[model samples]
Target: MPVRREHRTRTATRTNCISAINGTAVGAGDHAAIVWPLLCGVAKAKYYLMTADFIGGREAERIGLVSLCAPRARVLGRVLEVAAQLARGSQTAISGTKKSLSNWMRMAGPIFDNSLVLEMLGFLGPDAREGIGAMRAKRAPEFPSAKLPGAAQ
Candidate 1:
């Protein structure tokens, strides 16, 4: 679905003013190791990413993961309004500010790359197969990794 498509197509140059209308947010790709910690905080990011917990829009905003939450019907309009406001500002100033803020993520680039490598390794393992199967079956994954001796249940 849409989440998978988003994960595949997401680009770094996209505007960062995220607004969620409906549905839960899960840490995906480099977002878990890099973007989430920068948006929210380390503790909040760790709690959600490590648990793979789904966070609703309102809670996401409250936790600073999202810029705002809007009603489903109003989401597009709200986003366009924010865009228009940005478009009216001094482009150079906005671009400079954005670039400066993005340096935070740039500093974590090596960590993000390492996490991506680990994520790819996970995809090659049995747990990934179980995770995909569970998603397809609409059930909880009995991850093969969790079955190892002394592993947490």
Candidate 2:
């Protein structure tokens, strides 16, 4: 199924801009270790690291982020179609597959726990304050260097 973000106008998410480029960059720990796996999964983590996680429909489809791509106007129809298809499939198989995936992710529960702590540490840092300040001021954030102890250098 295709999962997409809402971006109907010129305005888009600041997270993408912040993460993709240097002025909008996040430190290695939060982006790489915490947010990456939680949001993009392990296999696609490298691409997100390089792109700062900015992805749209076509790009998402290209990288297997989404199973399908369609114009914004068609998103609902597409979702319905995909849902109907899945609904018609073997209910037991679908449930089993979903259960397996959930179990696999749960196996890494401890890692996710660590990631949350690391991310919270970022939230309490100077850069996080600067990011909020920059947003309020409608200016680009001047991110400080990623110097969190134990973060990759």
* Index of the highest-lDDT prediction: 1
For candidate 1, give the lDDT.
Answer: 0.74
Per-residue lDDT over 77-133 for candidate 2, one digit per residue giving the tens place of the 0 to 100 score: 777777777788787887666565456445554665675666679799998999899
What overall lDDT goes with each candidate model? 0.74, 0.57
The runs of at least 3 residues in candidate 1 whose Cα sits more than 4 Å from the true structure, single-residue gaps closed, are 1-27, 147-153
Count clashing residue pairs per candidate.
0, 1
lDDT computed for candidate 2: 0.57
User: Taking the tens digit of each residue's C-alpha lDDT, what string does model 1 give over 1-153?
Assistant: 443345434433545454435554444544478778888889998898887777888888899977888888888888888888898888888877877776776677677667777877988999999999999999988986675677667
| TM-score of every model versus the real structure | 0.78, 0.64
Candidate 1: residue pairs that collide? none
The number of the candidate with the highest TM-score is 1
